[model samples]
Target: MSPALDVRRPALAHAPLLADPVAAALQAWVHADGVGVAAIDPDLADTAAFVEAYGVASDASANCVVVGGRRDGVERIAACVVLATTRADVNGIVRRALDVRKASFLPMDRAVELTGMEYGGITPIGLPADWLLLVDEAVTLAGRVIVGSGLRRSKIEVPGADLARLPRATVVPGLGRPVG
Candidate 1:
């Protein structure tokens, strides 16, 4: 299938462009099959800069954020995926879904350490099996979306339906609200 972003190349054809875990997942994770990857300047990994530099539509890109909170003195963590044009309702939907009193974005160092990925390049693929994955409904309906490749030097383009099928993923309505 054609990608939402015109610049993507078949991921399997350029495994070196992907991070280790990302490459492994693309090979083994059934949900990531057929996804595309594209090399990009590491300086433009962030959504805004990546979209602008690559001339990709903002809505075609998605962000994966790490969040966590404590309940009954037990910490719980999850990954939230939402379109670049919107922001995850972490304080509301995520906190409730995690069943924690409060939820906050994970510290960069901690997130990077726990996920074994770069701070700005975390993706839902290859995440710890225990971490819940919350994908906004809008993303699943987008047909295709651009996401991190677990590295800053490349991006993955996958069918939105594929993301919804990832292990531990739950499609959440209103998970993301339009950014002001």
Candidate 2:
């Protein structure tokens, strides 16, 4: 755990997402699932900034990127988790896994609206039920990791293996490639 970071229960945060029925349900689900939540300054919610400010190792921080594509004129979305040291293979691995021809990051507005989570605070725990959740194999091997808590003001820390066990989550090898 990052030093000086305050870990709290989701219900105590009073985050906007917790007020929404869907997000609230997801919050409860994560708690019951045994994930720990840590509150931080909203301004430092972005991965790089948070790591720099809080001394969290980048390799132990997971980033969740929302991707969108279409098949048969219907939109398909997925939430992909990868270590901050790597980039999700959105154009290749993720595209192939999702069975979509062209895949790109979901537009911010749509992602935020659909997940009911802040842009920099989306996690695999409470995503849309129908959307795919892909966890990079490396993430699951990293032991404990820091991830978003559905609110920019907080984050979740859990064993990587636990994230891989989220409902609808699939562990994909090479889902993320090392950053140059």
lDDT of 1 by residue, 146-173 (tens): 9998888888899887899888999999
Root-mean-square deviation (CA) per prediction: 3.2, 2.9
lDDT of 2 by residue, 129-156 (tens): 8999999999999998888878788787
Off by over 4 Å in 2: 1-3, 8-33
**CA deviation > 4 Å runs, candidate 1:** 1-7
- Number of the predicted model whose TM-score against the real structure is largest: 1
lDDT of 2: 0.82
Query: Candidate 1 — worst ten consecutive residues by lDDT sum?
Result: 1-10
Model 1: how far is 106 from its true place, Å? 0.4
Highest lDDT model number:
1
Candidates in order, TM-scores: namely 0.93, 0.88
